[model samples]
Target: MTALAPSPTLSETTRTTPGAGWLLRLHRPALYLWIGAVAVLAVVLLWLGGPLTDSAATAWREYDKSCDTGGSCRYDQDSIVRYKDVYAYTTAALTALPFVVAAWAGAALFGRELEHGTAQLAWTQNLSPTRWLTTKLIVPAVLVTAGTGLLVALHRVMWTAGDGRIDTADAWYANLTLHANGPTTVAFALTGLAGGALAGVLLRRTLPALTLALACVAALRFLADQLMPHLWPAVTQVTSLADGYRGSGLNVDSGLVTATGAHIADPGCGSTIVAGCKTVYADLDATGFYTTYHPESHYWPLQLTTTALVLAVAAALAVTAFVLLKRSTAAPARVRTEAAA
Candidate 1:
């Protein structure tokens, strides 16, 4: 009888098997798409920051000068509208990146493999489930982080270029502009990736996983938006009722301040500018208008705090996914071991 060949050890088998290389090859299309998107967005952002902003600024200057002279105003009106349109589109696209990441990670990255038994097959090939999951998350997380970081930087550059020049430029605290111009968007994207992976592992069905992942991302964003202003202490500006609510930025609260040092909600009217509102304020014993808001100086603080919160959530999701995978795969291994014995 022929001598039996020895079985390969786990370490030897793992060493021979492809890890991220195999993954890259399998998801080549997605990798290409992501790269293409980044390149296109980068080019557009550059254009926006340079030529587009210049043209818009020039047009605004011309319009302002004409108005100052009290002459018939004439300027490149189209340039102003074009700048606004492009700015809106780019900001929207950057804001939507996280949801795209969530959909792909849920449906194609994890759900498809687990749903079709491919993930199990990979595990049997000398790869532990944990290693498999780790590779999946790590590779995508790196790519997502890098791409989003670059895009956010570019977006910030573009936004800054137009900040003081374009009359209609979005304020630093505008929701879409705020997220796109800072690290918070990058954090949101990573959170989306982790949340999606968790959804996929938990559901093991493509459609359901995709749905749940999107829902999770949406909820996270909503909560972040609601919590952003409170992340930093807002500056309180109190102005006489005649001056009205004068502070601007991310408004946390605004109300009427009474002589008794009590704060009461302002009526639907904005300020004492309106005669009716003045009467209302007088009746309420309002001594002044108090506005609490996060000014431009607080932008980074808000962004950083929100980023930290989102990253923490992402970490928790990733850990949960790993633990769930381990428990799910452990039962089958135990059954196999008992049968063999």
Candidate 2:
């Protein structure tokens, strides 16, 4: 009759009331892992960057030419484009990590309780399913978003030095930006939340919920990157006919060197500036070679816009939540072993 444990409100089937401690206990490991990884990445990147190093002169010397006759002043076919180092590499990496992290968080938050049948007991504690869901959503979302912001800051610091020397569209650069609607990180968050909620309603199990979230992320990225472009009309490339033209034979601005690459063909290739070419091109009557180079305006908009559109697909998946949860009940199918433990 020892007060009967205050009339024991919580059923044995319900999960522990899960105070703030519960969140820390459950999530700290993951938080530490990511933080550690980011730290290592930051250190490595900083060392490689050589904070005091100066490469502006070298970069300019390596590239910078003008047009006339043949066109295409700069020749850079081998090195990794600098803009790529800034935009494409960092964006791709930053955008991808969030997907997995978001999915993991979603699967953990929504799927766990439902799968455990603890939802019923937890709900009875003056809390609706929505309240419980809200707590779950807010905590993890903040953590992930904070982490994403930090990573973005880190990227900005690490790559700020390489502003020129490479167009942001060549093999490495892509002027992707987040200001566009439903950019990659935003899409990852939306999908993660929606995935968790949807998985909770549909699978009613933790493991399955996590699996579904990961699978959806992967499948969607693949579809967006590979197939989606073909679904609509292609964005025709805009070439720079102006950048062409190495100049006429008499112009002497061809920058062609005689002793350099002159064998079968006219090796009359000098530095991009006029002084470098001299009599080489004049003597050889050097034939100009030009290739199509897409215009700068076309670089940032098309791919960035397309990427945003593709990421917005999560919106469709998000809508499924209301339908699935509404049709399903929180009550257990039978019994959950985790509840007793």
lDDT on C-alpha atoms for all candidate structures = 0.89, 0.50
Model 2 clashing-pair count: 19
Strongest candidate by TM-score: 1
Clashing pairs in 1: none
Regions of model 1 farther than 4 Å from truth:
1-17
The local lDDT score (0 to 100) that residue 75 gets in candidate 2 is 46
Candidate 1: tens digits of C-alpha lDDT, residues 71-142: 789899999999999999999999999999999999999998899887887788767899989988999999
In model 2, state the lDDT of residue 167: 38
Q: What TM-score would every model get versus the actual structure? A: 0.94, 0.53
